[model samples]
Target: MTLYGLTAAPVARRLGAVRPARARPLLVGGDPWAVELARALRSAGLEVLMWAGSEEQRERIREAGLELAPGELLAAATGRGARLEGITAVLLLTDEDDFNALASTVLSRGAGIPVHRLGPRSGDHGVVAPYGGDDTLLAPGLTRLGVAHRHAQGAHIVTHRVDTTAGTLPDRHDLLLLVRPDGRLVPADGRAAPAPQPGDIAVMRPRC
Candidate 1:
């Protein structure tokens, strides 16, 4: 199976190439993926703060000479009502899927920060970072996760969401499969277009 690098149309449009302040990515995990992600983020000119998963991991992080963030400290720093002083984005690379999901939810809800995941392949609706040693791709800001599935003939199917209340509605097309809040897929085929509301998912196969 071929895994293509993720490209975001909405995120790129929102964050134009103006080059904002350097990013400070918070990486949580102690695995090689976390280390590699840190290196990649640094190479991208982003400041990194790493959190070790255990005592063994702590030694590794320290040996790597990265800023070590403890669990308690991170919780206090990113707790509810805490101000976002300088965090650009968050990467949850834990081995456990549950912790990763919880951390993503808490951080996103508490500080309005976007969290991405690196390990544990499929399951949650979190941002999945494709990571290789010293060669990872992590874009700035929130990236809603999506998937591509094979379709009949030479076409491919892609799906994404517009769940956030403040999210902009993408262009409407007849091939688009828009899911409503009540779990119904609304097709853009010949019917009155539904109003763009919260909790809508759009699926489409880009015509090449």
Candidate 2:
């Protein structure tokens, strides 16, 4: 069973990388992930509008000097009276997974923009397609190298099939749950565990 590495290139091609000039991502909710995402997007020079769910959340975001979305989707129109059509992309970063799914569906149907969710959850969220490229700044624990804060926050367990034909191995201090080719979820602690073979699924939250 040979192992392969999955890079941002292939995923970018498949997901159609968002152009900076055309990137207008609407962030939903007031979660830490949403805050970090907004910061990252702005750092990249993209326009961002946020809907933080409550007045408190909105105030917090405003204090941070970010733009806020309208109270309701019906009021979400551009200066020229165009509806959500101006939105290039939508990101659902709420803590409620169900709410995220519902909002994503609504935005996709109404705005016709690419919608993405933060972590793995139910329903069809765009992260499954790995839309963001290497330049996409993400909250910790979403990627293999995001295990820095695991000690304080505990690890975020993520389940995914190895997209690469060559597969990958767990680094030291990381935990892995290998779903064998025959469909077995086996736990392997860190470096002691063997490399995941091709076609095998892995649940990895690296300690990096």
Candidate 3:
């Protein structure tokens, strides 16, 4: 909230908090993987938004039928936009490792918002301690390098309902995100376990 918004605490209490019950995640990257994820989220009945630093990225993001976040990346993601409203979480998947780490730290600290970033390229030498591990931010093969390589090889993201009785989950697949029956959106980038109950929609990718 801005300085002016701070004074409206009593008014806010009467009106109600900004966010709704369901999750509205704001993706903070401009890759094809990000676009696919955003589309799947919307299809699953969650409102999704994306932020792109370049015009090329914005064009593709819009072409995918997603909305673009206004203002700069960190500012908008940190609730410094028009208002600290619907956005529930920020997923930082930019190719730049340092920028992702920096933004992750800032959003977690300043904004008090949940943040998830891509697996860092910096390893142990990284300036941010939390974003160092391959499994820390995202799953091993979901990083920019890994996703880019797979995208080039015809691997695409897919969303499906979890019906254990139908068959076992695919062997060579990675679970990216999960949308529960209650409209809770969960990111399964190794940060969260895959709890697939019947009738849940899962966002996944082939391990090819």
Candidate 4:
């Protein structure tokens, strides 16, 4: 299935509603991408646990004032009393494809944690499988999409009309600018909108 299909907006909306119940994510790897990812997750209000591969990388994270747990991803995930409780997501930011793939497989099977892989390359080989089970967030694509979507929906206030094109329904109009589903306006031919259900048409205007 496609990434958009895998990530249902409504599900994400619901998940975003309640604070994540899993422990803060445990990032595995010592690359520059891993450091940046830890910072980003912390900014998003999620706890970040770093598992560095080397002493130099560990020091870098320590100097940055973030929590550090010295262990590889597999070791950390498999350690006794290791529960993923409160982890919102798991990010595999390693440069090694083999490491990222193995981490993704293990997390999904072992802890049921959503795993995302970050790297500089892209291809079907890099795409995580077990289809629709876990999530993989690649560099640039996922991040860019998120940034663009946020920018598009960031206006404090917006006004729009809901014009109907069929069925004897009266034309409706509403104004909203909020970021949530209730206030945003989805246009015709918009791929971001939910899939159509029975009797749904392209010109149906959402009522406030």
Best by TM-score: 3
The predictions' CA RMSDs to the true structure, in order, are: 15.7, 14.5, 6.0, 13.1
Per-residue lDDT for 73-158 in model 4, tens only? 33333343223335555555555554555555554554444555543233544445323222444222333233234334541112
For model 2, the stretches where C-alpha displacement exceeds 4 angstroms are 1-21, 77-85, 119-208
Residue 52 of model 1, lDDT score: 60
- In model 4, where do residues sit more than 4 Å from their true spots? 1-23, 71-85, 119-134, 139-208
lDDT of 4: 0.41
Angstrom error of the Cα, residue 94, model 2: value is 0.7
Cα deviation at 132, candidate 1, in Å, is 24
TM match of model 4 to true structure: 0.47
lDDT of 2 by residue, 1-208 (tens): 0001112232222223333444566676664435544654554455777876567777878877888765443333222321333455666555554454444444444343456544432236443323322222133333322433452375444455665665765444343345555433343422245467786666555354
lDDT of 3: 0.65
Query: Can you give the TM-score per candidate against the true fold?
Result: 0.44, 0.47, 0.77, 0.47
Q: What are the Cα lDDT values of the candidates?
A: 0.45, 0.47, 0.65, 0.41
Candidate 2 residue-wise lDDT at 188: 44
Ranking of all candidate structures by their TM-score, best first: 3, 4, 2, 1
lDDT by residue (tens digit), candidate 3, 54-77: 788889998998988766544533
**Candidate 4 at residue 146, lDDT?**
38
Clashes in predicted model 4: 6
